[model samples]
Target chain A: MDYISRYLAWLGDGIRDWLLNADDTGHKFALMLVAIILFVVVMGAVLLAVDRPKRVPRWLVTVGFVGPALLMLTFGLVYPGLRTLWASLFDRRGQNFIGLDNYILAFTQSEFQIVLRNTALWVIVVPIAATLIGLVYAVLVDRTRFERVAKTLVFLPMAISMVGASIIWKFVYDYRAVLRNSEGDLIAQQIGLINQLLVWAGLEPQQFLLNTPFNTFFLIAVMVWIQAGFAMTVLSAAIKAIPDDIVEAATLDGLSGAKMFRYITIPSVRPALVVVVTTIAMGTLKVFDIVRTMTGGNFQTSVVANEFYRQSFVQQNAGLGAALAVILFVLVIPLVIYNIRQLRISEEIR
Target chain B: MTTTPPPVPALVTGGVGDDDAGTQSSRRGLGLDQRAAKAKKRLTSPWASLLAAVIAILWTIPTFGLLITSIRPQSDINRTGWWTFFTNPTVTGANYQEAMFGSQTNLAVYFVNSIVITLPSVVIPITLALLAAYAFAWIEFKGRNVLFVAVFALQVVPIQVTLIPLLTQYVTWGLAGSFWTVWLSHSIFALPLAIFLLHNFMKDIPPSLIEAARVDGAGHVKIFFQVLLPLLVPAIASFAIFQFLWVWNDLLVALTFAGGTRNVAPLTVRVAELSGTRGADWHLLSAGAFISMIVPVVVFLALQRYFVRGLLAGSVKG
Candidate 1:
């Protein structure tokens, strides 16, 4: 008993020093390695013990397999989710029950009204615009000479983190006020691509991300740029899966050009189109990174996700944040249902 | 069902004069397959090709612009747009050097932190989900379907909904602001999707294979290790790539838990902070952005096939 207690004390000290108090990279790595080993040992023992001479009970084996995941999910996801829902009804300190006051503020407050309005705009615009662009681009480049390269060029943005993509687009939208020399000749050169194009077109350079309502659209452009690739990849596969016989029959019927595309292509890929739209919508609804990185949700551009982060962490209003998060979760439920319905419909059509 | 190799080589190697006659003859007296090919050719009008080219260029230009800015001298980058680099042609590596090793930026440490955070976050979830998925796929238990559907439905609950309470819980457990918290949070959030995807893959494995193994005195563990695991390598690889990229490129989890300190923050968190604070520091931001993007882009390009397979199988948020 003494030896076991001493061993556990030593282990506790090591964990505290190496993991909880991990201050260096070496210590962090060591802690990670130890945690991995501990997990492996525990799991290995469960499997080995169950595999021994006399067979373990079937239920025991099932428990050994499923217990760890269920425990983690319950503790980490299910509990936290329920707790957040409960806390949304309380005050910022989570000590007093406010009884839907947080939800009322979220819906009625002028500031949060804009957040909700902007999120609605994002959910509506991003999916439609991205899907349209993706569909058109997919059709135009369906089997082009450089099909692989063309698809990859668009798809590459999907690989970039929203943070990286935000920085890239923010640079593209960079603005510098025009200046003149003593002689009144224009001296300041435009640095951002869009502003330079504006200057070249004999129009005044605009602050793309500074204007209140329009800035939100510019941010939405970045999302569409990233998601168009996803839409294209999925729809392209759908387009390819359209049987050649159908295409030949359409051709024999003299269905060519826009006529063919409208009559056959769109109808054929409707299921993929629905999936892409809903998927992008769900993704856009929870997008906090782009807004956070580019504008920090300033300029009246805060969506629900960013507002939730701000209210929770930045403003220390846990109740409002939880309400916003709950709102986001509620918003996604419909999209998921619609997506599954469309998937089933398409399967039935097939 | 006829699959003719596209006339790509002919289009490339054939001279303009020969190209027309060759395609024209092939267009004549052909099957519906050949007629469909001709119709596709007709669809690829010059206008269509130009439109495709324009969209491709539009998609490629932003990243290309950033890549150019990352390499240009800081003074030039600040003075003019990346498009202007073609006229001036000045270049430098100072930005990358400063963003990485300089005391102010120190993205190198965060880069290591990303690697550390990603590996365990990827490995642990895959390990746990493998066992859970096996049970879900093969084990006959009461409430199995209900439990599987419950896990699938959990994907709808955005991580945002759970962040606050999870953070509080982490603090209670004395794990806040540590790599362990980040790892555990990511693993937990990833569980639903991982279990669902791996279960799908496991379900595809033939029951006969498992039954044959079980008939030879193999227990569940033996069947799992000796029978199922060998067939699961590809599925595991696909999911690993997916999870690796998701964790590496993630900002929200890292920012919430580990962004408070340089000791544990990943590259995404640091780069995002740089964007906010040093918004005009183009040189550092550009270099930092690329430094963060390089790993995922490389992984994506190399294992694109697996990545796309995973994407198609389940593209839900990680």
Candidate 2:
């Protein structure tokens, strides 16, 4: 351990010296900047060349069109995915193969089960609640007096980054047990807003983010608050797409109110509903920010993404983290496939 | 089966005219009935509107608290609910001053870093996706369907799987901790969805318009810029908002590659530091959080209409 620390410090010092001394790092960095600019220039040129009379050579077009995309995916995505999968089958140091032992451990561990359950709960609750709230808001605000204003207000949370949102909510959940007045009288003041309100209502100030199951729910509320605006916009468009003539026909048949919605409205907007639900579901499956920011996945609130980060980076148990990542990939792929298929089908109908 | 012709032409025309007037009166009565129905809807379902209002308020509570905390003194914040500041009215800009200038971790510098990262991230993907979208929509090519499907399928691969391998690759390439690495990664991750969305919108352009341009010797480039790009303003604007918000808010990639390093770290990473190391400083955090939120809020508000139009444009069309 002493040797490792000494080596790391030495390496850090060496890198620092190199960085300070070398003019090439700056030059190379500048060249990279120029390359990025040239990349744009070359794309524009290729776009212009391809649009010309004879059409740029088919080979040039193909290379121009597909080269960057293929390179990016291979280097950035495919390679990483394959490497992670391979690492999952190895030991913590990634030197020896263990062949599914990590997977077995993941299944058997109580904490892993809790993570899975909490993830499932998040996937189930956040998407549904967000979609429903958004749909209802869309319906209420559709063609109303305050449509733009209401939407702008609700969508405000989406602008805040997850870390920022977490910081904001942390203060909302801020708790300090001890307090004193200038006179030095002891006061049991709860700093968190919800707890203060609880106390005001003549109840005990509860630790909202410390409790197990309820804490998970509390964390989910933050995501729902952020996502509901997205749902509202998508679902609102779907609602608007319901043809007026069909609605008028229903009214003619005296099928007013709830009956009209059941028979005509929902069926008309099924495609949008599928898109909204699946999009939210896919997002929920990889939820990391709220969990990471609020509790750091403590107190039985860890999901797969957060746990994967902890095990791989913090704990340096790369094998288990890779296994969890593989599981996440498996869960997300089917949803992506379904979403694409749905998109294609919707296009075909159009 | 033949029915007998009972009426003469004069009587048929006269009777039709009389019925038209009668129907007009009855339609007026129907209009009154519609008004009554609308009134009943408002009266009976008052709870629906009330419920929406309540939910909106509930949703805004956390953000409201943060805004209040940003204005309160650190002593007041540590000792009381932000709501207490509402009644007591002991507001101060000291936290904002401290968050901005007092700390070694300068948030303003981080904000500039975020802008530098975000602009390129938005620009690169949109530019690449525009070409790809044009090809997918208009140009005929071999294996197009398979390629599109593959790209779409790439969306399913969780980002966690790619982080380490990409990091190792960046290290080997000597690009790790560089802005280009983060920019390229953001662009790559954003590209698949961008192509899928932009292609959907591009397909909505009338085929005849492109065919006309092609016949007139307008090349793909000419048509793309002169003909198609203008029409795609709404699409580009909307996707820009999506990509901008995404890259700006992104913490994971920023953490893995550009984290904790001065001169390169983005706002998300900087804001994250406040909580972990300076956890006791609630006032500074609240102020920093608001600062971080400012750009995205402005971006959203400025481009919201385009966002809605773009979403519908992508989804509802081919």
Candidate 3:
């Protein structure tokens, strides 16, 4: 017993040190490679050891294959999830029982109400705007020269991290105060793209991220920029999936240009449009990184997921944070249902 | 459907050309001449073509500005916008140098942390999900459908709801802030979607293949590694690319489990912190953000086809 305890203590120390001293890149790289290989090998070995040529026990095979995943999910996700739900009913300190008070505050309080409003605006605007842009772009570049290059330029943002994307847009929305030269003539040149255009058009540069209400839309623009690619890709495939003969018949029936797009193209890709909108809406609901990286949810820009992080980690209000997360969970339920329903409808139509 | 390739390529190019011939023929100028005159007549409506070009320019210009900024002198970045470089061209590697090895913003360490966190996180989850997906797809077990439904439903549980309790448990187990904690947490969060996606792909494979292996006296493990694994390459590639990008780019998970500690915190957390504390330091922010985004950007551009396949499979009926 003493030996085992000592060995465990030593093992714990080793791991703690390794995790804490993450600067030695070479050592850490080698260690990580070893750890991954060890995990794969151990799992692989157990599976191979259990298999028999002549006869295999069904339960044994199942246990050997699926057991680790089930165990991890139950412990890491399921139980922790239930615990958080329970914790949401407790007070800030998790000591006193305060059933539904946090949830009530989430809906009633001024700050959280703003969070909800921002989330609603995000969900409503981002999907529509992104899908519209995506659909338009996809249709435009369908068979044009350099189609791949055009699509790739739009889709490139999807590859960037939200943090990366926010910086990119933040640069684009950058503002500088107007200044005057020695002759007292104004020489204010806008730095950001949109602001520069505004300057050239004789309009005042706007504070894209700081102004109230409009700021949320500005932030949503970043999301739209990133997600437009996804919507375009999926919808493009759906457009391609429309049988050639159906389109051929439409063309013969005098469907062309606006007539074709409205009558045939739009109807054909309705399911994809639904999928793109809802998928993006679901993603928009949980948009935390952009808010965090750009304004840290300041100036009435906080969404539920970002609010959850601030409350739990920064503010130490566990109850409210849990409730915010629960609200996010509740909000997604409907989108999921709607998405599934549309997919089913699309399947049935086929 | 079984004997022939999909009719998409021909139909896409041909139908698209025929449908747009009317509107595009009228646009005589505006670079329409670059296209072979025959192809120009078959292009999109002039308005649409113009709109696409505008959107594409708008999308690419931001990153282009930042890319220019990342390579510019710090004084130049602060004094003028990236656009000004066209008139007065100047460049430097100082910001990248400072963001990586400089004080308080040594992103090189965090970049390593990202690598460490992403590799095992991707490998472990994909391996485990493949095993579970194989069982869910092939192995006839009691309550398989119910179990899968449960797993599928769990995908809706946002990572936020799981963070506090998971952190509490990690603290109790003395694994908080460790790479082990992150690896385990990421793998757990990824299992539901990974299994669901892989199961879909696995189901598309004919039962005869598995049965053929079974008849040849191959056990489940043998068939999984030898037979099913090979045919599932595209599907595996699709999910693997998504998982790679997801893990590498994740913020909330890393911040929750590994915040405030430089050793375990990935590049996103560090870049986010930099953006907040140094909001006006566009030089460092541009350089750091690009540094963080470099890996995924390269991976995405290189394997774009698989990435698109994943996107379609994720949203479309594919």
Candidate 4:
């Protein structure tokens, strides 16, 4: 027994070291290969064991497959969630029980107030802007020659990480407060696209990411840029699925262009529109990456999600972070409920 | 919340009266003058075409600029706009080489870490969720609907809410700051949605098949493996791609669990840190951004139908 425990711990340490401490990438990858193989074998063994016993009880077989997922969700999600909620009630170190102080601070404090404001701005602006752009594009390119290629251009960003998009847009917004030459001609060029366009228009290149309040909108543009593709793709399908008969009838009603779009097409895709708006809203609410990568949540561009990370991980302020996280969860509930309600309503209409 | 936005302009470029069914590439480059005067009439509304073209160009330009910048010489990159490539074109693989293996930023390691972290994160959640999904769909458990809804509701728990407590738990187990922590964290974050999506797919399968198996003395495991698993393949592929893209692109969970440590941190963390710490290095940023984007973009383009199906599944019933 003593040897078994000792051997187990040593094996654990060695595996951990190989996986987490190896200097060479080849070693780490090789170790991952071995570990993944072991994992598959163990899973295969469990299933094989259940398979061999042909007359196993219904409930036992049910539990055999479902139990692992249930246990993981319980330990990984449910317990930690409740713990975080509980921790939100405590003070900075999480030792003292300070009722509502963290929540109050998150709301009333000047800095966190900015976070709430930024988050609100994000939720409001990103969805509407992206959905509008996406819907417009989806409608125009519904069955055009270049429809797939056009839609892919926009939807491509949804697959890319927010980090990548931020870098992409950060370059677009990159501003250098460059000095001028003898004829006031620029000696230093603005490499960023937006700034260069401004420069081309003979307007002074503004620091797009540094100016407060406006910077939030600049950051929001990145999200809109990415999410619009999602809006277009989903909404396009819904438009296509609108039965051909409905379109034929609508066309016979003298609805050809803008009038048809205004009256028929919009109403037809309402469910999809709701889905797009709410999904984008929920996604926007939880967006930390754009803020993190673009500005590090500086210049008052921090939203609740980014603020939560800043408070918890960077500042080590557990209580505030927990409170911020709770606030995020709270904020998301309405969107989810709203989304579910929309889903239900759409189902009824169908 | 329920109100739809105004319908986009109904400028159908191809009119209702027209069927370009026989239209092929032969018509593509033919000018209205060269082909026929009536070719111009094929456009129902030129204004709509113009608007769509403008938006598409606007959308593509940012990435286009970055791609140009990525391949440009470092000195030229800093000196001129990427659009200037049209006039004085310069291309080099130096930025990619430097970003990948340079002492300052060996992004290649983090790219490998991204792959490592993403695969297990994707595989575990889908596997576990399939089991849970099967149970929810088929089993006559006591509180099945309520439990399923509860699991679905868990999706609303912003991952930030779980990070601190989960991190503390990991530290207690001496697993903090490791790939295990990332794998576990992503798997956890992914389960609620994965389960919900798969269950929706599973419930759509006819109960008669399962009933027939049950009548033949087959148990849950046998029914699942022999009958349901085959039908669930497309649904599973749809979700596998969804989870694959989600895990690959995740930043918050990765950052929280992996914490910028070279051995575990994904490309996102490294790229983000570079933007924060060395904001001036557009050369490295462009290459790194492209490196991170290339896989997901290719996956997206190739398997787009499945990806779109998953998106619609979340909204419109498939």
Candidate whose lDDT is highest? 1
Which residue pairs of candidate 2 clash? A51-B219, A51-B220
lDDT of 1 at A348: 63
What is each predicted model's overall lDDT from 0 to 1? Answer: 0.84, 0.74, 0.82, 0.80
| Tens digits of lDDT, candidate 3, A1-350 | 99999999999998767754555788778768877988978997878777874565788888887888999889987888888899899999999999999999999988788999999999999999999999888877765667778888999998889989999899899988878799965586666778888877877788989999899989999999999988877777667566657776987897777787898889988877887898888888899999998889999999999999999998999988888888888898888878777766765675
Model 4 chain A lDDT-worst window of ten = A49-58
Off by over 4 Å in 3: A1-16, A19-21, A53-56, A181-184, A187-189, B1-44, B314-318
Note the DockQ of each predicted structure.
0.38, 0.24, 0.41, 0.40
Candidate 2 CAPRI classification by DockQ: acceptable
Model 4 residue runs over 4 Å out of place are A1-12, A52-55, B1-42, B311-318
Give me the runs in candidate 1 sitting further than 4 Å from their true place.
A1-11, B1-44
| Most accurate candidate by TM-score | 1
Q: Rank the candidates by DockQ, best first.
A: 3, 4, 1, 2
lDDT of 2 at B63: 88
- When sorted by lDDT, best at the front, the candidate numbers are 1, 3, 4, 2
**By DockQ, is 1 or 3 better?**
3
Each candidate's fnat: 0.62, 0.48, 0.61, 0.62
Lowest lDDT 10-residue stretch of candidate 3 chain A: A15-24
TM-scores of chain B, in order = 0.87, 0.83, 0.86, 0.85
TM-score of 1: 0.93
Residue-wise C-alpha lDDT for candidate 1, range A1-350, written one tens digit per residue: 99999999999988686766666778778877887888789889887876752557777888888989999999988998899999999999889999999999999999989999999999999999999999988888665555667787888888889999999999889998888899965587877899999988888888999998899999999999998987887777677667778888998998988898999999988877888898889899999999999999999999999999999999999988998888888889999888777766665675
Best by DockQ: 3
lDDT (10s digit) by residue, model 2, range B1-318 = 001111011011111002122343254454545434543563456776787688778778888888888999899988777777758998799888888777565787777778777877888878888888777777777887787777766766778988877888888877778777788888888877787777777877999999998899876677788899999986688778767878888888898888677656788988887787787788888888888888877766666555444333332110
